[model samples]
Structures are given as C-alpha cells and as structure tokens.
Target: MLTKRIIPCLDIKDGRTVKGVNFVDLRDAGDPVALASAYAEQGADELVFLDISATQEQRKTFASLVKEIARHINIPFTVGGGISSVEDVAPLLEAGADKVSINSSAVRNPQLINELSKAFGAQCIVLAIDARKIDNAWIVHTHGGKNSTDKKLFTWAKEGQDRGAGEILFTSMDHDGTKNGFAIDPLSKLHALLTIPVIASGGAGSMGHFADVFALAKADAALAASVFHFGEIQIPELKTFLKNHNIPVRL
Candidate 1:
C-alpha cells in the first residue's frame, strides 16, 4: 500500500499564518515561512499554504509568499486561495508551488478544473471542497465557508473528479477545529466513490484521530492546522505513532 501522508496546513491572512474554528474566529499562528521550514525539517510529507482571505478579500494568493515558503521547504508544496483560471495558476507554479488548490473559484467555474488539468496535468490540480452539514445534507460552501451553495459534497466531489482533478482536499467545516475527529462517514464515502487520492482536513486533535481517519475512513492523507501549529502534535512523533499502529507513513 502507498504510504499515507501527513500535511500541515498554513492558513494565511494579512500576511500571517492563522488558525480558526469552523473557518471563523481566526487567531494568529506564526510566521509561515518559519513554520514551513520547521515542518520540512521535522518531516512533514507535504505542506499546504493557503492565503485564506484571498478569495473573500478579492485577490490572488501571495505568490511572493508562496515563493518564499517554497524556498524554505523541500517537501511537496500545494498553494491555494483565489486561484481561478489557468492564468492564475501559472505564476504560482513558476513561483515554486508543486501543485495548486482551488476551492470557491473552481466551484464557480467547474470548467476551470478541466482547463487546469489540461494545461498543468492532473498531477498538480487539487480540488478543495469545504462543506458544512446543513439540515442533514453536506452542503458546499464558498468564499471561505461563508456562503452556502446548492452543491452537495458527494456529487460535487464526483463532478470534480470527472473534470480531472488530481486530488480532492475535503475540509468539513462542521468538524474543522473541533478537535473531535475527522468526518469519517463522508470521508469513507468519498474514498469509495472517487479513484483519486482524498486529503482529509480539519478536526485533527491527536494521533489517534489520524489513525482513525486512515484506518476507518481510508483517507489517503490527513491534514490539520491548530494541532500542528500550536505544538499540540509533532509530525515526527505522530509518524512514529502511526508507524507503530501499522498505518503506512514516512518517518
């Protein structure tokens, strides 16, 4: 089996790394460049750097910041926020992002996924879906989880796959920052429905949570923010724990 990945997400707002609960009540985390370098040295399998406010604020991701972070981290890096078209992706790739993630923009123009996948190849197009359970349905959200969309999580994820997205980065707004656990049921469903890798995000509070996401949900990767940012969990130790549990991870 392919080794599962552990990714640390750096949510950027106002040029600083931040963390929030359910996509609001944001708090400062640290300098992203410093954090990226640290995670690289400590053995993070990959890094996700998102300019969290770029979409809501009506701007593109900080390509300069992406460049700086990429310079520091040797691991695979995915950059996102405000990416909309093939035009938006080129600079980020040139700036050093191994892959580009798109959320609100992709939802707005599903064709953007095909265009990006065609232009950049499916290997580098990550479709990020942020959803919240509303009235028992997992409804997709946009503009950094502020607006509700008619798009349901399962259908939209499958549509994204058909559009040639390389991976699905699903963030459950209901579970985000709760530290309870990952949204296992939906994740498992996504795992079974999609052939591409699924990167599970939000609600990672402990090592056991990571184990459960992989063991139960069959998620390809597990991503977290606050736990890793606040030193609540360290990547090397987490990898050791997963290795002991027979969850394939790179230590």
Candidate 2:
C-alpha cells in the first residue's frame, strides 16, 4: 500500500505567507521562509509554495524567496503561480523547486504541459486545477480564482495526463478554507480516472478529514494551508492520528 502524503501549502502574497477563505479576504500567516522551516521540522511530507497573486498581477514567481526557503528544508518543494513557459520553470527549479505547478497557463496553452514534461521530465511537472462547483459541475478557475473557465474538471485532468503531467493538484475553490472537508466525490472520480497521483486540496479541518480524504477519496495526498499555518493542526500530531486510524503515513 502506498503511504498517504500530507502536504502543507504556503499561499504567498507580497512575499509573505497568507491565508484566505474561498480565495478572498486574505490575512497574513507568517514569513514564508520561517514557515517552510517549521513545516519541514514537523515532518511534513512535502511543501507547496504558491505565489497566489503572481498570475493576477502578471509577475513571475519569487524565485529568490523560493531559494531562501528551500535552503532551510530538505523535503521536496513545489512552486506555482504565474508560470507560463519553460523559461518560467527554469528559475524556480534552479532556486530549488522539486516540481513546477502550472494552472492558468496550462489552460491557455495546453502544449506547454507537453513541452515542460519533455524538457524537465514528467516527474517535475504538476498541473494545478482550481475548480468551483457551478450548476452541479466543477468549473476551472484561474487568475488566482478571480476568473472562471469553461473547462470541466475531469476532462482537463485527462488532457493534462495525456500531455505528460506527472501529477494533478486539484483545489476545490468552493471548499477552500471551509473546514468542511475535501470534495470527496470529485476526488475519487479523478483518482479512478487518472494513473498519475491526485492531490486533494482545500477543505481540510481536522485529522479525521485527512484520513477520510486518503481512505474514502483514495487521494494520493491531502494539502491544506490555514489549518497548518495557523497552528490549528500540527503535522506530527495529524500523522499520529492517521497512523492510529490505519492510514499509512510517514511519521
């Protein structure tokens, strides 16, 4: 059995970590470099750093900050936001990102996925889909969840895999920061349809939520921000809780 992964996400705005509800009313969480070191010390399986406003603001990801954070942690680090081409990915990787996540750019130019996979190997490419349930169908959103796209969630996931993406990081805009739990139905469906790993993002409130996402949704990993950033949940304690509940986690 593959051990489930618990990842903590750092949503960056103005070079500082921030958190928000349903992608609105952002509040400061902490310094990104400090938080990254703490999460790594807590045994987090991975760390995701997203320059949440980069795409909307039309700026590149903060590679210098990424490098500063990467130096403090030993775990795999993934960076996203405002990444549009292979050129955008190079600096982040050179700054120590183990994976590059592309969202709006992928929807705009699907070929970029194939190009990135071929250039850096699929293992380093992660397709991030931010979707919200509209009329009972999940619709992809971009530009930091400020814009919506006509593309449906599952169809896009399939296209991403065919284009050689190594993993899918699906964030339910509706469930983001809700603490209601993951969108299990969609997660399970995506997991069943894709051979690559599916990371369930948003709506994580407790350890039970983490276990449910792993056992019920069969998500390869669960990523959360506010809960981890605010100290509402600690990775070490959450891992212990999952282990007790029969969820295989690296403790």
Candidate 3:
C-alpha cells in the first residue's frame, strides 16, 4: 500500500503563519520559515506555504520566503498564492520549491493548468480548490475563499484532472479551522473520481482526524494548518496514531 502523506500548511499573511475559522478572523501563529523548519524536523511529509493574502493583495508573494525556508529544511515544499501565469511558477521553483500550487489563478484561467503542466510537468502543478457547501451543493470559492463561483466541486475537480493538474488539494471552507474533522464525504467522492492524489484539507482537530481521513476517506494526504501550527498535533505522533489504526504512513 502507498504510504499516506502528512503535510503541514503554513498560511502566510504578512510573512507570518496565521490560522482562522472559515478563512476569516486570521491570527498570527508564528514565523513562516521557522514553522517550516520545525515541521520538517518533526517528520512532516511536506510543507505548503500559502501567502493567504496574496490574491486579495494582488501581489506576488513567497519567493523570498520559499528560498529561506528551502535553505532550512531538507524536505520537499510547495509555494502558492497569487500565482497566475507560467512566469509566476518558475521563480518560486527556482527559489527551491518542489511544487507550486495555484488556486484563484487556475479558476480564472483553466488553461493555466495545461500550460503549467506542459511547461513543468504535471507532477509539480497542484490545483488547489477551496470550496464550501451551500444550498446542498459544494461550490468552488476563490480569492482565498472570499468569493464563490458557479463551478461545482466534483465537476471542477474532474475538469482540473483532464486539464493536466497533477494533484487536487481540496480545502473545505466550511470545515476550515473548525477543529471538528475533515469533510469525508466529498473527499471519498474525489478519490473515487480521480486517478491523481487528493489532499484533504481543513477541520483537522486531532490525530484521530488524520486516521479517519486516510482510512475512511482514503485521501492520499492530509493537510492541516491550525492543528500543526498551534501545536495541537505533532506530525511524528500523528503518524504513530495512524500506524496504530492500520493506516500506512511514513514514520
């Protein structure tokens, strides 16, 4: 069986790690580079650095931060936020990011996915979808979950795969920072629909949530921010918990 990955997400705003409920009411968690190094040292499978305000602020962010974090950690990391074109990806990768995640930009121009995949190989292009349940449907939200689109979650995910996205990082806006659990139903549905890896994000409150996401939803990876950022769960301990539950994970 393929070992599931545990990713620590650092939501950056003003160069600091921040976490919030439903994508609002942000509060500082810690310094981004320091947090990245800590998680890497703690046996985190990978790190995701998202400049949370990049899209809304309308600026390129994280290149310098990515480079700094890269120097401190000897593990793969992904940088994202306000990345729109193929030009935007090269600098981050050159800055030492193993991958680049695109959300709002990809939603605005679906061709960006194809262009990026063709330019840098599909393995490095991650399509990040932030969605929320509304009116009995999961609608894709953009601009860091401040705006909603007509696109449905499942359909958009399928389209993203066909468009050459390497992996799907699905964040449930409804469950974000709630400390309840992951959105298992949609995660399971995503796994059923796609061949590529599906990363379940949001609402990771405890170690049990990690096991549930992998054993129940069968997510290829579980990505969480507040839990890891606030020291509520340690990556090494979470892996041990998963292993006890008979879930395969790198220890």
**Worst lDDT 10-window in candidate 2:** 20-29
Q: What local lDDT score does residue 202 receive in model 3, on the 0 to 100 scale? A: 92
Kindly list the per-residue Cα lDDT of model 1 for residues 4-74, writing each as its tens digit.
99998887876667764222222323577777777888889999988766354434437677778777778
Query: Which RMSD values do the candidates have, in order?
Result: 3.9, 3.9, 3.9
Model 1 clashing residue pairs (backbone): none
lDDT of each: 0.88, 0.87, 0.85
* Candidate 1 vs candidate 3, lDDT winner: 1
**Residues 1-251, candidate 3, lDDT per residue (tens digit)?**
67999998877776666664222222423667666666777899998887766453323445667778888889898888888998889988888899999998988999999999999999999999999999999999998799999899999999999999999999999998798999999999999999999999999998988888998999999898777665778678888888999999888
RMSD of 3: 3.9
Q: How many angstroms is residue 71 displaced in model 3 relative to the true structure, after the best TM-score fit?
A: 1.8
Clashes of each: 0, 0, 0
Q: TM-score for all predictions?
A: 0.91, 0.91, 0.91
Question: What ranges in model 2 sit over 4 Å off?
Answer: 20-29, 53-61
Looking at model 3, how many pairs of residues clash?
0
Error of 1 at 132 (Å): 1.6
